[model samples]
Target chain A: MSMINYASREINCKLVYYGPGLGGKTTNLEHIYGKVSPNTRGKMISLATETERTLFFDFLPVDLGTIRGFKTRFHLYTVPGQVYYNASRKLILKGVDGIVFVADSQIERMEANVESMQNLYDNMSEYGYDLTRIPFAIQYNKRDLPNAAPVKDLQASLNPGWPVEDAGQQKVVPDPAHPGENLVDRVSNEWIGHAPYLEAVAVRGDGVFDTLKLVSKMVLKTLS
Target chain B: MAGAASWSFSENDFKQIQQHLLAFLRDSNARCALLVDRTGQLVATVGDAPQFDSAAFASLTAADFSANDQLAKMIGEHEFASLVHQGQKESMFLADVAKRVILVVLFDQRTTLGLVKLKGKGAVESLTKIFEEMFNRVGAGPGGQAGPGGTPQKGLLEGAEDEIDKLFG
Candidate 1:
């Protein structure tokens, strides 16, 4: 839920980072925590197990400048990626305003990405949020790895619900009034898994902010 | 929230709320009193405690209440009306202000739990009325939002700019 606190004169929105284990969900948050100036953010908390794997979640609150008269505050949360932590994952999804699915781009981690995406879909429905309408973005992370799969194939596998076929008339569902000149530019337009997708190496801070910017823009747009 | 973003406050509303919060603090004699949305954002605070991280405290407090709510369901109760944590000297009292908001009071050796609880009930009742009026003025639910009668954007941007200089510099 997005909250408007009359006493504080600020708007607060919750954005969750979700994906499979070691797929850079936490890394995305850590990078944001490192780069943002201290005054712009609060302390980042990680609820982790003895092995330091995220046991519950990682949370960070950031000030995304200001929009309109309200100071825009985004609470970023990352759920435990391990499969057995589904219950904890569901808990984090409550009242979520937006979502970033940090998919591991490595060829070997492809299956985990698909399973995690499905889990996200199921968990979202349980809370009455439709992934199709929510401000949802995707980050194909670990792009620095040599075994990283191509972004096209990763999107097709992970967002199977979206149309990824690139041949014949079915490939191009351009709007009649505003026709897209070509396929490449049009692909990034409306279909973006309902938001935008970016290639990222979260650990190195590559495309991390871009991912945040994309989701934040979508979230603020929804608010307006 | 899924619909249009539908909450707002005027400067006068902020003033009215601060008066109640301060009055609550004086009555309870607590180190600080925080009103938080159930989603874990700190709605307001009144008291003098520079050592506390109100943001983190708000987040953890919301999560604690949520976990307890789940536990209540498991135990076949609607929910706990209040939660108290007693320490050697400083004790914390948390109560539900409105169904949507949580009120927390951190009191120390200067006060007793019974006194805090008694004062807190009165605070919650007053705050509930204040919040309900605030929301009703803004058209909180459904398609209504803070449209024409909303506060102007003139001074709020300047407010942040002033604070940024004081904190960061």
Candidate 2:
């Protein structure tokens, strides 16, 4: 949910980073917190276990400068990626303005990625949130790993387009990041739309900002 | 879009909210009070709040309140209306306001929990009424509308792309 504080002349939006355990969700947050100018960021808080796995969530509030005189602040959050933490994940998703699903790109974590993705859908459904309608993106993290699965394979498993039922929205929508690729197109006589995605090696900070920038733009577009 | 509940507070809305909060602080004799959205955005603050990161504090307070709500369901309760965290020197009380925001009051040895609770109940009632009126006036529902007038300002997103580029540039 976005909070428009007219008195303070600021707009605040919440963006959540979600994925399976150890899929670099927290790492994405840590990278952003470390990179953004301190003056534009707040204290980063990580509710993690003793071993450093996210226990509940990690939060970072970043001031993304001003747009039309309203200071835009985005609160970045990462849900605990472990399976048992589904409850915590659901709680963190309340009133989310945008979402980044950071999928582990390695071959071995495929099942975890699929399960977590399904969990995301189910949880969003419970809140009556249409995953496709929101400002959503996917980050194929750990791309630098030797055993990283092919992008096509990951796309097939995770980024398959959902049916675009509305005729008004069924037109071809190109993915600006990947020329010659359509984010929304007719498939097997059915219009389908996929969330825009980018590959990332989060630990090395590669593609982190690109992913954030993509989703942030989508969110701003919604607000505009 | 579902779950897109944006809340807009005009100058008049804040003035009224702050008045109530100030009165609550005076009556409760609490150190400070923070009106935070359930989504973790600090709506308003009154009194002598301790030096802390207000943004982080709002986020954590929302998380804490949310986690407690889940805990309530486990025991078959619909929800826990309010929560109190008592520290040795300083304690805080959090109450739900119209199910839209959290009313948090911070106090210390000078005030007793009994007094804070008594005053907090009245504060919550007043805050809840204010939020209800505001939500109704703005026509805000699950599908959020823009500010009080239901129109977004021009150029809100026109130069946003350039601003984002500068963030990393």
Give lDDT: candidate 1, residue B154: 23
A41 in model 2: Cα distance from truth in Å? 0.2
lDDT of 1 at B82: 81
Q: List the candidate 1 regions with Cα displacement exceeding 4 Å.
A: A5-8, A162-194, B1-6, B136-169
TM-score of chain A of each: 0.86, 0.99
Candidate 1 lDDT over residue span A1-224, tens digit each? 77765445587888899999999988899999999999999999888988878987888999987554567889999989999999778778877888999999999999999899999989988877777667887898999899999876985687545443434433443322224422222354533222356788888999998788767666665554
Fraction of the native A-B contacts that model 1 recovers = 0.18
- Candidate 2, residues A1-224, lDDT tens digits: the string is 88888889898999999999999999999999999999999999999999999998999999987777889899999999999888889999999999999999999999999999999999999999999999999999999999999999999999998999888998999998899899999888999999999999999999999999888878876766
TM-score of each: 0.81, 0.94
How does the DockQ of candidate 2 come out? 0.56
Clashing pairs in 1: A1-A95
